[model samples]
Target: MSMLGVAAVIGVTIATFTTCGVGLAHGTGTWCALPLVWFIGFPLAITNALIVGLPLAFLFCKLRLTRWWQFAVTGFICATPVWMELAEPFTSVRWAQFGLYDSLNCFGSGLAGGLAYWWISQKVGIRRGTDEIAP
Candidate 1:
């Protein structure tokens, strides 16, 4: 639980920075957008962490599928639906109209977030009963 919270914070921070970086690249108001991005991204990231990530984590544990690549793939898969909803690809007449840049942003964030969570969990050693597994 605490791990999830920490991972969420890290994920949100990465996302906020990514957003600001993109804005800066476009010569937009990057600093002015920082607060808004953090405020909005934090809650959503946390919610996604709980609603989607938690169950997947448990399932991975149960199946002994704790590889780093597996987590990265899971993160990418989880982010896809969220991106679709945000981009409203279904609502658009041309699916190609969906912004590839935004998709990449979300996917990258998710991948980083998953890797962060996996690294934290490994470092902290997931507790199963009295045995600690660091795999």
Candidate 2:
């Protein structure tokens, strides 16, 4: 896949996960619904990535961060908005809040996402007819 294509996938995935994290964090239900948000979430995720991920990728690249570190960083970066949005003081339940789980999820999601992007891009290679080339 081209960088743009890969970016699209990453963006979408990031958005989806972010939405899930935010939703799970703020939801008051016994259990969170994961599959219900795909329609709206996919586009939102991709758009978010395109809008946010591109600059992030460039920044990471510029900083000369390793791919593994980038994934960790990317996940943390992706979760920031969610964290910020859910920062309102809770008035009811205080046992388990969204912050801890959401933060962890964001970190994990970012690590996985970064690794996937790096792997896919490396596997796809830079030239046409050589997508099979392994990095």
lDDT by residue (60-110, candidate 1, tens digit) is: 787767678887788778777667777774556433542544566577667
Tens digit of per-residue lDDT, candidate 2, span 1-135? 245335445644664566565665667342434464356434444555556666776665555444555555674577456445544454424325444554454444445555666666556542333234445
Q: Each candidate's TM vs. the true structure?
A: 0.73, 0.54
Error of 1 at 46 (Å): 0.8
- The per-residue C-alpha lDDT of model 1 at residue 9 equals 67
The segments of candidate 2 whose C-alpha lies over 4 angstroms from its true place after superposition are 1-30, 39-44, 61-66, 90-98, 126-135
lDDT computed for candidate 2:
0.51
Model 2 TM-score is 0.54
Ten-residue region with minimum lDDT total, candidate 2 = 125-134
Q: Which stretches of candidate 1 lie over 4 Å from their true place?
A: 26-32, 89-98, 127-135
